[model samples]
Target: MTGNTDVVVIGGGYAGVMAANRLTQRDDVTVTLINPRPTFVERIRLQQLVGGSDDAVVDYPDVLGEAVRLVVDSVIGIDAAGRSVTLATGATVGYDYLIYAVGSGSADPGVPGAAEFAYPIASLEEAQRLRPVVDAAPTTALVTVVGAGPTGIETAAELAEKGRTVTLVCGEVLGPYLHLKGRRSVAKRLAKLGVTVLEGPDAQVTAVTRDAVQLSGGRELRSTVTIWTAGFGVPDLAARSGLSTDALGRLLTDETLTSVDDMRITAAGDSAAPSDLPFRMSCQAATRIGAHAADTVLARIAVEQPRPINLGFFGQCISLGRRAGIFQFASKDDTANRFYLGGRPGAKLKEFVCKHTLKHLADEARKPGSLTWVKDDERRESLRAKRGEAPATAERAA
Candidate 1:
């Protein structure tokens, strides 16, 4: 629809990078990516970083496209009416279209003293800070990990394997996303690693302190180091910018990934909530949503009818230190099934998935739009039904 279309993609995570690289498929599009860091962070391996295993970083040159411009800056405010973004560096960048992909950070622990005492390993910077704290602690010091999600399980295992006395305090059930069989497999692995698994109502953490964690039923455990991996919260940039957002601050978008408030704005990754149904925050959904966001923008520029997003789920992979893991298979809708892979083979598969995620971004950078994912027909149908739209023929990306 124009001579040169300028698209500004905020956030340099998997979603933003994929969207930026895919936008380069068209000659008329000029993509600019803005992020707080120059290097890409491997969020999936942040636990490994905290455990002193991996660095959890990738150079932008290896993942960002040559045609895409990289701006190492943080976006403070977005002027939707003026079509510009005010950066923290006091510079403003104008764009014909904006792709919101700021991703997420650690959620606030509602419990008392949690924020002040517990270390969060959600972001790369947080992981880097926690690594030193973990190393300085005595080998026999009591380390307590709060949460039973993949991050907590992995972090607890990683630390315990390093010869630290680790305890996993699952506020709720361990691996709530996993089926009973998968959950058992994980428990077995954690037991093998000498990690104390605390579950049931008594396992709920009521408060965190300087040297101990208070749990339910008047239980208190000595914790020299406490790591919080409970929940994730997105940036408030969208809501602060006067854009429509969900309760969690994720930008609200239609099924097509276009912002419901403004046609010129779209969202992807953990920062996007489409049709009030947001995908689980993971690298698997981030890449697909990022690619779909780019396609939506490209279609609008070409004056073609943009296709709605079609995404599918594979499984959930969790690493139990460097030697063991669990791969819980999921249905297309992302619910954990009974099938799972445990032990060494599971660890290898988890490692492969982490490496493959980076390789995908690199491949998309070298060849725009080279990445593709499986489609969930049921999800598309449900979304269309919710919108009162008639069923349409399926279309797959090449």
Candidate 2:
């Protein structure tokens, strides 16, 4: 099976980039990364893009291995049976192994009028489209940020910091993953920034309109711009290509990150669902899984046994603004703890985390096999045991 092997990585986000770069550990493996854009998007800084603090992109040469081929195009379909992928440009690339890391984007709002009226800043294009509208709006216009996730909070705070009026409508809770204390800290900062923090069950947005937003409590708030960050939706490429996927359309994979139905295909990043329990969408999880995906492919090439995912989280970081933020600590299982660092220190930490994401990719690109991460020991195993289920496994040695 081997003179030279071509590996096609379909996505250029954290996971895909990490996988492509790490795949360079073997001189005989050719890595080609396909993405819709040429530059590596720093998704974590997208909110900053809207705020005009950052553009949220890095040149591939800065973060990708020089040996990896960069294909600037979108993948339209995958032929697992034939070991190839078709791009939007009507070109097909055959691969000995495929890494499905097509990351997620904004979810269908489902709320009445949301799809047509609300702006989503999840991806680069979306953020670029939103920035101008926000800037063009009158300074007095009320900006409504829907959803209380990290993106929502960050966008609201960023806008508010820029002297734009912001209203954060939290359908359920503000920073649901944050400890109550951390949530309070964020609330305090938002209040200081003159942002209206609306939470609780009745805080749900029932509809978005050209000039206003309606809440579940029958209260309507006048708004000039509406931003949606409630949830994410992954690309339907897997399902469209006839691969088994989770309800959300992420490729169903085992703990080894290999496709459940095909050993030659593996998935990582936000588009990957391992054990049918996908990790929360974040750059942290994506990079870790990306490295593992490359490891899985390399292990197969070496005919060595690949290890299951042993990923763990340090915590969540949320930027309140350029000078204020929150770093919520979490347990190994990714549950939020009450302990958190807030204020200027938290801001510094958040900034560092964002920069470090790129640094990790650069480090991997510079030294293909140099990246290392903390591993979770027993939480997932204990959870699987309680569910009375066996971890998903895959065949090795492609």
Candidate 3:
């Protein structure tokens, strides 16, 4: 609506960068992205970062639009009413609209000694911190990777391939999101890597120590390094700022990604809880949501109706070192199918996905709205059905 329109994006992850780049479509819109780090973090490759195979940091100019002003500062608080964000450096930056894309970090383990002993590989700093510690440990040292998520599996494989003795303690099942067929493929690869895969309820970790990790079954294993890769948790910025959020502190928003409490604020990435049901916390969902978030703001500026988010996940891909991987195919809704590409082919595909993700930001940075993703009308309706709402009901709510 105005050349002076100011949009500040908090977080420079995939979602924030995507939003910031797409916002450049409107020359009148001034976009400023505030992040704690100067380089872009490739979160999907954090395991590789820990393994020292990749650095996981990209220059801001590589992914961010040239028009975007990069503010290397953390947002301590958001004054929604005043339309300003307080930075950690004791400075306040005003904004006409704000996008919350802080993404996520490893959730609290809630087990004894976990916080003190286990290292999480969620953030770039965490991975950097773990890399040195992992390198210092003897090759014979027992490396226990807790949780069965993609992060845990990838980390376990990454370390094991480096000649480190590794053990993967799955709380219940390895790759719980993967279909049985896909799970078997991953298990076979881990086995080939000499990674001890522990499953079942008894495999659930109940405690951790500097030298050992205790399971729920009363089994204690000697572990020199414990890597925690459990659930993900969002920043408390939304809650602390007195904004409406879900129980996990993700900013609650409607289908249009607009905060329920303030129309001027929107959320994207792992930090967003749309209709109290967040999509899986991954770059797959983050980039799409980020583009939609920017589109929502653009729609508002144009005085047009903003459309609801339409997202469809393709499937899951877990790299078993750099040599092999398991890429499970699925419906648009994300449930794994019986078919999948395993071994070297899957590894190549997984590598392509990671590279293309960065290319997406760069492409959008140059072309603004050049990015596109798959979507299904049936999938959208099913999501609303789960919320026990009709199409008209969701429309009015939005």
lDDT of 1 by residue, 44-154 (tens): 999999888899999999999999999999999999999999999999999999999999999989999999999999999999999999999989999999999999999
Scored by CA lDDT, what does every candidate get?
0.94, 0.93, 0.93
- For model 2, residues 1-398, the per-residue Cα lDDT tens digits are 56898899999999999999999999999999999998989999999999999999899999999999999999999999999999899999999999999999988989999999999988999999999999899999999999899999999999999999999999889999999999999999999999998988789899889999999999999999999999999999999999999999999998898999999999999999987888888999999999999999999888888888989899999999899999999987788999999999999999999989899999999999888888787656655775886753422222
Top-lDDT structure, candidate number: 1
Worst 10 residues of 2 by lDDT: 389-398
What is the clash count of model 1? 0
- Candidate 3, superposed: residue stretches over 4 Å from native: 389-398
lDDT of 3 at 228: 94
Using lDDT as the yardstick, the better of models 1 and 2 is 1
Segments of candidate 1 deviating more than 4 angstroms: 381-398
TM agreement with the true structure for every prediction: 0.96, 0.96, 0.97
Q: Write the per-residue lDDT of candidate 3 for residues 271-313, one digit (tens) a residue.
A: 9998887888889899999999999999998989989988888
After best superposition, candidate 3 residue 135: deviation in angstroms? 0.8
